[model samples]
Target: MNTMTLWHITGWEFAALAFAALLVGFSKTAVSGANTVSLAIFAAVLPARASTGVLLPILIAGDLLAVATYRRHAHWPTLWRLFPAVAAGVVVGTVFLLWADDAVVRTSIGAILLLMAAVTVWRRRTADKEEEPESVTTRPGRLKARSYGVLGGFTTMVANAGGPVMSMYLLSAGFRKLGFLGTSAFFFLIVNVSKLPFSAGLGLIDGRSLLLDLALVAFVVPGALFGKWAVHRINQRLFEQLVIAATVVGGLQLLLP
Candidate 1:
């Protein structure tokens, strides 16, 4: 394995990486859907093939902070329901990664992101037609769970963009306020942790990746702290709107030729 030098990181690149790190922290704490932007920024700054490896550790660091802040809020049932399907999808994605061209992966990620954004917007419109529920539902319908579980698993495994997919599913299923946050945190924590062995097996977690992660870790702390503060103040409708818009833009960028 060769050492990755600081020379690869020009001032602008460093700024991009730092900004991405901050977004990672914020996304982990406040809105899981914003990870699409962080994914795009990281891939832009690093080799597309190596970006996932480089970003995973930094994400895990941010995950730890999120879990600490929102552990008690997680909806364990939803997490459990999504686990098996997600694991299977991760295995399938790992196999695909072993042979897929970088361009194919990028295009697939972009397409999926665009698809998810459309679904989210459409779902929101449909939800608006229904009366405001007196209570939130934690148990997603079986068919809905399976649909989201498969898509979330495939997207997250391939591009680390499953947040939007799952967010749409949960939103459509009618989780509100803390239930949404809790379910998202638990789902991602399990999915991200599950990805470790696959990432290592694919040679994505080398020393160079670790060194880069170390540099990015500092930025996550402040970003997460800010996200924690922001989550409480932001209205649920406004937050979802912002997340959808971000996802649409990130997906298009990834798809660019």
Candidate 2:
């Protein structure tokens, strides 16, 4: 791989980074679905392989802000139950990252996101008429955790595009408002940090990428602040619909040749 020089960052690249960072911040706070835009932008600006590494650090920065904002509302039991499964999924995803073809990864993630969106929409339409009762044990929750975890880890590791996948799962599980934000904040905080080793091992993070991350970090703060404000104003039904729509578009982009 060729090394990028610090001075090589063009005005347009900075613009792109700033915009992507804004989306990251917004996603952290307002609509988690917007991270798909961030993922697409970063991948376009940098090498697809290095984009995840470059964006991960910035994402962690944003995650810190999100946790600080919504820390009080987290559902510890839910997060705890999901941890082991998510961790397992991360390991599996990392292994695949080491060997999978880029095209295969992209298409698989796209298909998964689309399928998840379809399921989520179907469930939502049927939810009112016949609401499913919560399971007795954490088994059902764990299964959900595993399903979302594996898919989240895989899509995120490959393209930093797991936000919608996880969002759909959590929304379907019926977490409201801050609980949803808090849970997402914790989940991604762990997953993004865990991905660092795999990224470093792949030689994706380097001096130039770090410099870019530094520049982008500043944009996330305001974006997150905006997101925090937007959350309260959004209606639940509309939020779910928007999430589904974004997931569909993101998935189609990935699946496109």
Best by lDDT: 1
Poorest stretch of ten by lDDT in candidate 2: 131-140
Candidate 2, residues 117-231, lDDT tens digits: the string is: 9898887777754333222111235667778877777777777787898888887887666767887898888888888887888777778778778878999998999988888
Q: Residue 99 of candidate 1: its Cα lDDT?
A: 85
What tens digits encode model 1's per-residue C-alpha lDDT throughout 2-81? 23743378989988999999998998888777878888888887777678877877787888888888777676777778
What local distance difference test score does each model get? Answer: 0.79, 0.78
> What is the TM-score of each predicted model, taking all chains together?
0.92, 0.90
Cα deviation in Å at residue 193, candidate 1?
1.5
Model 1 ranges off by over 4 Å: 1-7, 128-135
Worst 10 residues of 1 by lDDT: 129-138
Root-mean-square deviation of every model: 2.2, 3.0
